[model samples]
Target: MDLYKIDKQNMEKIIGSNFDLERGLQNLIENNLELTLGLEFVASEFTVGKYRLDTVAYDRDLNSFVIIEYKKSSKYSVIDQGFAYLNTLLNHKVDFTLRFNESFPEQKKVEDFEWGQVKIIYIAGSFTSYQMDAINNPALPIELFEARKYKNGYMTLNQIMKTSIPARFSHTHNQHKREVADKGINIDNASELTAPTEEQLLETSSENIRDLYQSMKDSLLEWDSSFEIKPTKLYIGFRLNHRNVVDFLPQKNALKVWMNLSKGELNDPEKLTRDVSHTGHWGNGDYELKIKNDEQLEYILSLLKQSWQQHRIEH
Candidate 1:
């Protein structure tokens, strides 16, 4: 509180003593509007007609806008402020829907924004019992942690920031960990196939499946560019997103799904469940097709595409 201290050398300690992190953030954003929006400086205090927001972070990637509010908590709670900020942001954007395809015709597309899809996170040094409760039941995006100075008394908060508001463990990360958890069969396994024709053989037997897999995969992408692969024993199945498809198989946690190739085509493989047991990774993850004969690859390729569709219909 001393206003007479004019020593520049002791300024850091003084500033640290009065760091006021929340205010520092606010001031930083106000001074350099670009910092807040992560884009060019817009306005000190952006007023969308009538509402005034602390900072507006816009991303052209998804054509989205995020309203950020900084807080310095002397007490323990700042949940109310977060909710208020969310309210203001949503109110101002009564008609503000994300329209990205209009900008990037080939990159990505987003439909709409629901309150549930949006998030409001409260950042503070220490969260209170009340604040935690606020973020609990309805899944509010409130996160709290003490901000400390680097050896230099300057630290940023993005290190521990959640991937998404109300951040949950990413499904992709969970899938990988699940694969790692399973004891892998230590047999050296690799297979490749070339060309979309010819019973699509070339398994652990030939090195051609690689070309065939890539050719088919590339062709599949022409249908849906976002399609990705999740490998199994004989082949990898293409899907929009692994997370959604994996959800279809309730008990299967591992990504590498093992189906009976010798059992027959997709229709009769259900009966071949005898020799076919999951590699413990029945879910979606990267994998190599372990086919011995080209016929197996053809069966696998056909069943791989058919299995998912059938599962969808059956479900």
Candidate 2:
């Protein structure tokens, strides 16, 4: 995509600049980890055995550690390096848990974290078609982000989407299965490794709660076609252009929602949303709302729209 500056009906192309890999892009992302990826920074250059991880971040939504590698050059293989890091993390889960505990003293127990949801993220200015193809598996918990910096101090970060390919190959050689040495990844084991699906989460909810969640889901989709519904073990996330706007935690009687807006940015005229900036919550954002009926559904959605628009503007 091309960026341009328009003045008096004349447009000027904005040239992009590149900086030193580690000193430039990597540091920039590390400093802005929370804003860019909704992840908490753990430790940089984290070493386990002989391998050194570029950046270690905590995914609060999934309660897992995410391994991130930044590449200024496109000469490396995503499959080999990504899986290698994942294997290292799987082997040294305790170290990661301890690191998180030390970095943020709020989390108390090792058992509270989700070790199975450990994912790998590779970020670069751009990726080659071959590199993109190397980690395009749907079941694989790997993500690729492309970062672009413009001359006008504007930057863009986009996740390279995976191609829709049918699973015809055997699981023995699949990337998801190959991550584990002998016991290949299967449906039974996948429950422990990956996030739960919308079906799985809604299955435990009562009839009325399920209906209420369905109504909210429909409204969320209708609000923006680009919004995606991502279900984790604890909650269902709604995002637009890779930025999470809201998350839903379904209960037997009510649905708990957390908006991505900041502490006081939410404009809740009805005072329905609670300020959770200081409180420890399962979802993102400082604002939370509990919905149980259809009467306030429209009003709640309006509040959610404010959050969605605020995130859109910030990104």
Candidate 3:
């Protein structure tokens, strides 16, 4: 993909620019972690054992620590380095807790952190085919983000998404035992780290609610090929470039959606969205809406389009 700059009737291609991996990109991302990625900034160049992390950010939604690495070139293995950093975090939980506490004393208890969903992100100008192939497996909790720097101080983070990989096994003790033995590492169990499937998440919902959720989900996917659905323990998140645009929390009778837009950014003429800026919510965005039926489905979708358009790289 390419970027362009428009001036009145004239248009010009914005050439990609080089940047210092640490000083330029890393610092910029850390400074706007919450604004850009919806993550809380924790520390930079944080050392644990022999490894020094490029950036350590906290995800309050999942209550997990995020490890981010910036790569100027695609020379190293993303899987090896991602897991190595995750392994370090898993082994030395106390050190991470201390670091978080030192940085944010008012935050939640360290024991309550969700270690099961620890995510590692690798950001670079581009990824090789080998690097893309390495993350095709669903067993890994890592994400690849392609970063681009243009002439007019524009930076884009595009997540390279992989096709869906079916889960190896679910709800079988024997399978779990085999996976445990196969890992051979004295680490946490594999079941705990495995992300729940969409079916598993909607199992408790009523038939009507499930149908409604599916309708909205199908519509979102039909909007574009870039739209991807990620089902987490808390909610089903829809994203472009791995940056969440909207999140859905399904109940027995209703589906709640949290759009990833700021307080005043949303253009809600129907007045269906409530201000959730100061209130504690399970999902992102300042706008929250609940749908019990398909009465306002089209209107709701129009609102979602606003969010999707705002987050992507504007032409």
Candidate 4:
């Protein structure tokens, strides 16, 4: 279980159970590549130039990737290996677009995708002091996680170290963009706003845009009574009238209502996230507020109220 103890028997046993060391590490590196780039999961492995990576994780929100080299048996110097793959990732980022276009052929505005950060991860049962010291002063931005295996062979990867949590989420409207964009920030031109583009056109005639947002926001406030609106440059987060929905344990299977306006269907689509486990679609079109039903809403409010009240007492 504590594979990090670095004993010969424990290390070898884990490698034997997990992989031919080399083969098994390669499989995990390929499969969980998503963890590197902060995406949910890569869903598959891919080659970088001539060199194959253990795993290549990509996060769509960050528009970034990570190179993973897993060591099932013994440790090898990954500096050169990770460096090679990192270069290739930066080089062939456009290939992602090509692959994407194959799926959705009409994606002409593909240049908007921005590449963020790349992390290098070493997943293994053990790491030598020398290896740890080497990674301590990384040449490129990298993170190293050590996987500890149990007697039952239940391996849990523990975060040994991380570069920073700046890239935690995919939403980027500020500094992250400045780093990715080779060019300095360009000021928005007022004249450009006058120009008519398809994106602008779609939002122009939508009557339900305001009406829908107000209705949804009002309903949330009505339910929680204290649901205030707070907008950030990226997306909105809320203090969630937790007093009302404190006990609402939302699960994956819970009917979650997400306000999705079709991409390319409109500019400034009325995008919101609502759990629709019980609520019906409110109104229709852009004004469509999908939450669970009235009963569910009441339950959510009750749970949130209890949570907020508990917090007040704790504070």
Output the number of the TM-score-best candidate.
Answer: 2
- Reference-based TM-score, model 3: 0.73
Q: What is the C-alpha lDDT of each candidate?
A: 0.38, 0.78, 0.79, 0.42
Model 3 stretches with alpha carbons more than 4 Å out:
3-23, 148-156, 164-189, 222-228, 239-246, 252-281, 284-315
Question: Model 3, residue 119: displacement in angstroms?
Answer: 1.0
**Tens-digit per-residue lDDT, 27-51, candidate 2:** 8889999888878899999999569
- Can you write out model 1's per-residue Cα lDDT over 75-103, one digit (the tens) per residue? 64445555445444545444333222332
Quote the lDDT for 202 in model 2.
Answer: 75
In the range 1-315, model 3's lDDT, one tens digit per residue, is 778789999998888865665468898889988776778998999999879999999976667889999988789988667767776777788899888888886755657787777888888888899999878766567889888887556888777877765653464334433543355434354555555667777888889889988888788778776676777778888867547788999888888999999999999987999999999988889999999999888999999988888877541
Q: Considering every candidate listed, which one attains the maximal lDDT?
A: 3
lDDT assessment of candidate 1: 0.38
C-alpha RMSD between model 1 and the true structure: 19.7
Give the Cα error of residue 264 in candidate 1, in Å: 38
* Clashing residue pairs, backbone N/CA/C < 3 A, model 3: none
RMSD of 2: 4.5
C-alpha TM-scores of all predictions? 0.35, 0.76, 0.73, 0.42
Q: Which structure is stronger by lDDT: 3 or 4?
A: 3
